[model samples]
Target: MNPYFCVMPFFGAELSSNSNKITPCCLLKNNSNIDEIRQKMLDHQQPVECSVCWNLEQKNIKSDRQYKNEAFDFYLNKDIKSIEEDCKKGLYSEQIIKIYTSNLCNSTCVTCDSYSSSAWSSLKGIKEKKSIISISALAQLDYSNIKMLSFVGGEPLYEKINFDILNYLIKAGNTNCFISIVTNGSVKLNPDQLNILKKFQNLNICLSIDGIGKRFEYIRYPLKWDLLLKNIELFKSLNINLSVSYTISNLNLLYYSETIDWFNKQNLPYNHNIVKYPLHFSINSLPKEFKSLLSIEAKHLLRKHLPQDDAQFVFFVKELGLQDNLKNISIKDYMPEMYDLIQKNI
Candidate 1:
């Protein structure tokens, strides 16, 4: 049976930087055998290359599949017959088009590498891979039915292409689309870009921040604490909807509660997606003692800030234990709480 007819499971696509090939999802690599994956998708069979979400499901983790599924179910005309016809017509009733084309960014974040950030290019000694969506290519794609256009980048604000696209869409009178961008919150949008942004029906900003003052600077690196705050206030003044993306990593594991409290005071909604890549950075890499202290702190914050899901407090320690056991370094030497918590928990 056609999955598109029902709640279509695999209707969305993500385009990566430097290579135009459509990927299974953002976390996975591009499908080398596009025709085969396309054929499997059309046949309502899950593509073999789409193991990222499949594995996530097996592990009982919420994957990118759920987010896209919700978008497709709500936006598309879900009458099974109409969707089936669209599928047979060889077109995706696409709900989201997540694009990442530029590696240009100001801060060379410790967790990121040259593949995603140009700032790390020289220091990383990796060959640059230049695969951006050109103007000629953008003009050829069909944006007629798409509902959401997500722009994620090395840093979206660092590239002129993002602003140009927004202006282009505004000029084209495409006001039905909901545009969202994930920025580092270090560079504020220019006056022209802000003015053009107001033309869209809706635009949302996800500020990528990891920690509180000193912790934040250490993790994101070279980004001044004051400047990041100034930029966040700048975005606030523009009167745009804002959300915080706190990537929970080992670098800031001890300060999650403080970071959440700071954003909570601003009445900003924040999400914590565990950092998986660069395994050493994952909170699971933290010493067991550090995780114990972090867990107690996170539990209280969850209760105080989000009483509805207080049970989620244990996620901190649970994730630490679940970490891939990469002990390349130890936090015990650095954190005083480690020595104290070790005695108590032990």
Candidate 2:
């Protein structure tokens, strides 16, 4: 057996390296083949037991007093000190801190649950308000275990508050922590602002772009698509890891492939999210034709990208099944008010 195959045991999937059939470790009576074991390892790189099988095994073991005692002894004798140390180094190094610098935004996007016009209008009325975090407050934070600090808002670059906080973090020699910002990429960052971001090698930025050309304008509303592209190019030139976050909705459901192709050409990592039950409207707020298209695209993507043994993908598909029910129900059936809201806003 190849020495690399020895790593397989750590994954808890018992199968011969030659045959590639996997037997579920949770199964007390059955043996696994090598292929089944490989698939299980690919499902989750992390060590995890099959929840259903584990529960079943636990029940069976409890029925047998001798087996139950053996299981208890095995667990008690397991030396997990090395595993605990590795986890501490990788994940527990820091607590994540999120700073909401300001609620002000330049663009009024249609899908913005965070900052609708009504919400901003109310915030604007607060007298003597401090929109930005003070430099002193940021310096006071205990950075003992802060793995990352995220700056999020109506749009981090819409105002000077974000820059203030970012500058403080950089100057404080807190290079150990990763710094990230979620931006619309509309505001053209100055050279000084760009330099500040570049100082932190672990800094990352997420740009939200839903579609290409006019479709983006329609959904994002008031956001300049060209300016966003220009800013993304600027970030690329700086050698920053720029991620495009695309929120999949009925408006761009049919255009998923087109958008993915575009991102691929741009050499940018992209992620997609299905429209969830929003605070304002139900599935009825989405157009029927678009909703149906979204369902089809979502199913196709999941089946194509997800492996059979992936538990997370299985759960994801189950959730998509519920959303697919909108095919029989029109958006107007549940969200008539959304039409009026969109019309009034537009």
lDDT of 1 by residue, 124-212 (tens): 55678644765655664456655777888888877888887776666667766777788888875677877777777567788888876
lDDT of each: 0.62, 0.50
For every model shown, the clashing-pair count is 1, 14
lDDT of 2 by residue, 1-346 (tens): 1111112123222222123333323233344343443445334332223332333244432221223223222333432343233333432222345565556676545455333332334433434332444445555555543445666666777767667766666566676556667778888878888777888777778788877776666555567788888888888888888877777653355567778788899887665544543412222233333234354444343212222223332343333333324223232333343333333323
* Cα misplacement distance, residue 156 of candidate 1 (Å): 0.4
Query: Each candidate's root-mean-square deviation in Å?
Result: 8.2, 15.9
TM-score of every model versus the real structure: 0.70, 0.55
Instruction: Evaluate residue 325 in candidate 1 and report its C-alpha lDDT on the 0 to 100 scale.
Output: 26
